[model samples]
Target: MLPSQSNPNPWSESEPAEWSHYSDLETLIIEGAYSTKQPQAILDDYYIDFKQKRQISNIDSNKQRPIKRVQRKRDDKHLREERFMDLPVGTGRSFSGEYGWVSPFIIEVRRHLGLQPDQLPSKDPQLIPMLVEKAAQGIITEAIHIRKQREAEKLAEVLLEKKNKKMKEVWQCCAYLYTLESFLYKTINAAMRLIGDKDHEEVWRSKVGTLGPFCLLLWDDPYNTKVTIEKTLYRGANLKPEQIAAYEEMAKHKNEYRSFQAYTSCSRNRKKAE
Candidate 1:
């Protein structure tokens, strides 16, 4: 005869299960459920807020509960298995096999999915070479697109550097022109003071017929230079008719050609202060 089993759990019928004993297990279970449910609740609240803010039509004012997707363990497994079974397999071939074909397009679908000939696991020999060729071409096309994007980024960087350099050069050119204008004014004034002071006869004699002390040379038909100087002077100095007339009178008494420097200097100084 088989031995009779003794009652091992003596307190099962006599006492209630202790709350402290089950506290940790219950807490863990509750925390897991809360974590999963919290996101759902948040989404629900957001939807409610959105609906409340939106204007409802009289034809569709009633609140309808969301239709949830039914949970099916078998369906999920079947879908996953189908996807795994559908992946393309490769035969043993050389790197540049007759099977390998290039894509007509630069960007194709296979490469986008990260598929490569070397990465395939199967060695099935029955499939047509054309299938592998097309797949390979697709992969290569995606790679080409990625490479082009990288190259474009590099080219953009080079162009940006060149543009910044050009901008800096322009700023420098403007600053140089401003400094040149200021220097020209000072030299003209110094030359004029010397010429007007008859007491300094020797100094006036040496410099009056020449360009100002700072100028390297002057040309008889310096047309472009003259236009630039005139424009600069007009913009720098606020010359009135009376002032222009007075300068013109002085030019008649002195060498007319030599008067250009003096006129420009005075005009620039007057305008600059204003």
Candidate 2:
């Protein structure tokens, strides 16, 4: 036959039980539910405040609550797993197999997070794992924005250079036209004065007197003329040698054998008419 159990309650027989003598019925009703087993004795022995105990219980419940795992994207995962040092500077993009601590970027992020210098984690990999996706997203967004801004600045600089080049070409062309016009005026005046002189035939015999204007028109000095124009027009420009030679040849062929005096007379008459 089995030994007779002394305890009346079946639960008390299987599980260990504790007894408390309550002074008042109100106290018993209030504390009875929580005073079961050995827990109440441990609480009492430690002199733990009821409110503090409740707070501890609350903390335990919070610990038990399920934490939602952040789902990382392929790119995000790569960024997180990769060494910050391997990421492209000023861009959030990651390179293949790049692993290292990007000290500057990490420092920047820590500053943004309001973390102090001493509070920075010893290891980059260890700290990165705890970073939420949102925070990482902010860092990436800032990096991308910086990259775009830099690109825009570079584009602006290129456009400005192009504009300056075009302006220089226009100025060179204007200067060449002015010089050509001045030469034409001087030649016309000399021809008009010499045409009526008794020494007109003699003047024509001397090539210097008759062809002086043509020589002046073909002046190709490095300091003040043809070479200067070439250098100015082609400065910092992309032009083939053949292209420059072809242009020069074309220029030399123009206005050949043209009657300068006759053209000048016509131009003056046209101006007077206007």
Candidate 3:
């Protein structure tokens, strides 16, 4: 064999002597040459720590398994109170030969409160008193239920349904109340269009809690003499970024109405006057 075929860069005597100075130098050199793409010494230390931590964690998990299982089982068990309460009037097969038993009690309560089928409570001082009475009745019913008086079940069901329906009705009425307020204020605003009565607009602005002098942004200018205004229109202008996007969406329908051009002209005149 040629001399070139021999080991080109084999470890020399001095190199081996230098390596021998370190206790595990030979093992380090071998690992560095053929092991993972990490610093072998550091990696070995990390791996040892990782193995110890994993063993500890496995032991901890084994100890906690029964406790976790018990907790899960407890969560799965339904309460007896819930089972009985869930049987309210129309939910399933009528209990004690009655369907929608809540209707009678609801009617009685509504009659006593002097409310019609659609009539909601006025914004009067009596409203809070009525709600308090109803809540008191609910508490009394709960007490009766706790005593295991089966006869009180009918009354309880009725009261519950009435409470639910009353809540729904109150929400609906509040919506209409807001609409009424808007209509009244918007009407007042339209009347003050060219007369420069800032007080009317100020009243609305105050009610709505807006900063500085503000007025509803009119969609179709009611002050326009050229076109006959049909429906009074105003939109809240104190808008956030998200509301600005909504305004742009509604504005896309501007061309659909026949009075749009006349409305635009009137709006332009109002701005010019301002």
Candidate 4:
């Protein structure tokens, strides 16, 4: 690679704990060389996790479906339980019944996108168009899986038809952040809200914990590499003394890394950060 070209991170010899949730295929792609160009087969693998695909296959071959559990988000008591108390607990045999005996992940996607229980996106094609911009490809992949699992093969086909639609949106959102994050205040307020004792930790964990690492990884890679390389970054500015103190309370010494859960902001512009 040229000096100007990115020195892509090579596959790690030891697997990372962060990647434990990734399927074998996903791991292979990440753990191996970063291929800038994606092939069609790789793209196909991008949508549905291989393990989930295998589960569906096994269900077909044995004619005996194993009882499966959708991995629950941590600390679901605050947001999911309280906000989504109306989530139906029963199952249904058709695609039209999203509220029916569907996986919890499906319910989460619906809720995240502001859909009603038992409301199928099929009934409102405009709903997909409206959400396509904000929808992450990974979540859409889960939706596709449920659609397929329900014997509503056609809906899955439609969802997969333009797999990159949501992906492009995600890319754009990331790109927007790269230039300027007007949402910094919103993000800071969110961090401020997350600051607290174990109960608050549980609530935040249940709500946005799944996104925390990925968002951190995104923030780390590009801004550090593309924007702030060899440049100074600042924090503890514009923040109230209490907010900074809160961060100090939460900070922990993790090996060489000082890990803190919340209560600070980072910026390249020193004055702006302050």
Candidate 5:
């Protein structure tokens, strides 16, 4: 049987650091859960106190400047209740489950019976490409499973175009493992001469693997990079005609963006990042 799913994960769902808000009730619950699961050593390493989160919240509230402003959202919620008291229509009728698609706890509690489960088996970064390959079993032919090579090419394209701090850090961390030889024999290779080639990719894969989606989720935070990639990067997959048409429709749809704050990742490439 497929893994049934984590019944009650310490993270609630594996929330990327970007979506974490200090005041969200769901955030409180998840963090509190992890506070229990977190190894004592990790807590000591981070200098977190070994106390109930309730007590920790009390201590931190004195220094927490953000808590002063969160009362306004509570007031707005009260106003919503007062102005439109018709239950689901005014409060709970969220066609989108509030902001639950990206973050958590935007839906009204009455409407939130159970949460959508996290689909990944676990959040391990090393197994990400394997997960994608398993998920893509029937979709494509054998030759195109070179996830790392494509990622390296994408990394190369980004480095050559910008050659800025973020890409520079990526190069420092990865160039030893991800070598693009198409430009190697002729002129001096500026993008750090690759030590390994496509022929020995398993060697590189064992070293660095693909920059898996979990890595992306962790490192893509602006707080970690101080800047993020704005240019479009493409990843191609074999798509049926109907799938292409469906994606074409999605491409035309406008998406609304919302900004929220608190917390972060560890990009080992840069000293200041995490």
Candidate 6:
């Protein structure tokens, strides 16, 4: 008869301690607060209260705190006594050569079998087949587990499909919420960009063709790709190793240098002519 198949429990025995602690902290902070009040505002109030209490305690403590004196001489003597004065005698050779070239494989096999490295019958060729058989059995067991896992996953997918079909309203609500969030995000981003562009234009007008600030503002403009600036800087002055490397990478696809071999060949020919 075939072995009885059982579904393994997917959930762990306990929720992670750190996650539980964080949830408790969140609950504590949000407890009794109006939903309209921001969490950050509440947290800031709590922080200020804590700091005021700490300042009061510091002001109240007039007397100097007691300082512990260290006995350096005694500590030094103790450390010296504890320290190793001499190294152990070195053996001429460490490893046994008896096992030959197969020693490493033997050690690895023994480790997988939960045996000590020296426990395997390294000299016996007959035991090799037994080891191979044991390894094959382990592989077969793992493969069976993997097959069962795939079956469980397929079953889960089918159940999920049915659940999703039943929760059409819930899915619609989620989609609506996501759409609203995305719309708000894009609106805010667009508003910020408009404000920034206006500010940059005002700054550029105030500067009125001033080289440094105008160049900086020009570079800061969203429309500018900065490729021209990068190339100009790369050619004109010494740059950082990272900047040089980036330029080299960008140079690869540029019209001037299509490939490393092309660049190298040109350089080599120039050098040969020189």
Among the numbered candidates, top lDDT falls to 4
Residues 187-237, candidate 4: write the lDDT tens digits. Answer: 323432443333444544453323332232222222222332365665432
83-124: candidate 5 lDDT, tens digit per residue: 222112111111121232333211211123221243322333
58 in model 4: Cα distance from truth in Å?
51
lDDT of each residue in 123-165, candidate 3, tens digit only? 2323433453453343334335244222223222323343334
Candidate 6, 121-185: lDDT as tens digits: 23333333343334223323332433422222222232233332322332332222212211221
Off by over 4 Å in 3: 1-77, 84-102, 121-128, 141-274
Scanning candidate 3 in windows of ten residues, the lowest lDDT window is 63-72
Candidate 5 clash pair list = 265-274
- What C-alpha lDDT does candidate 2 achieve relative to the native structure? 0.28
lDDT for each residue of candidate 1 in 155-252, tens digit (9 for 90 to 100):
22322333323323322332232223122223333433343334543543443222221121111112222333334432223345654565566558
RMSD of each: 38.9, 40.9, 30.9, 22.7, 24.8, 32.1
Per-residue lDDT value at 211 in model 3: 9
Clashes of each: 2, 2, 1, 6, 1, 0
Q: Which scores greater on TM-score, model 4 or model 6?
A: 4
lDDT, ranked from best to worst: 4, 2, 1, 3, 5, 6
Q: What is the lDDT of residue 35 in candidate 4?
A: 42
Give the residue spans of candidate 1 off by over 4 A.
1-188, 207-273
TM-score of 1: 0.19
Q: Where does candidate 4 stray beyond 4 Å?
A: 1-169, 175-196, 209-231, 236-265
**Candidate 5 vs candidate 6: which has greater TM-score?**
5
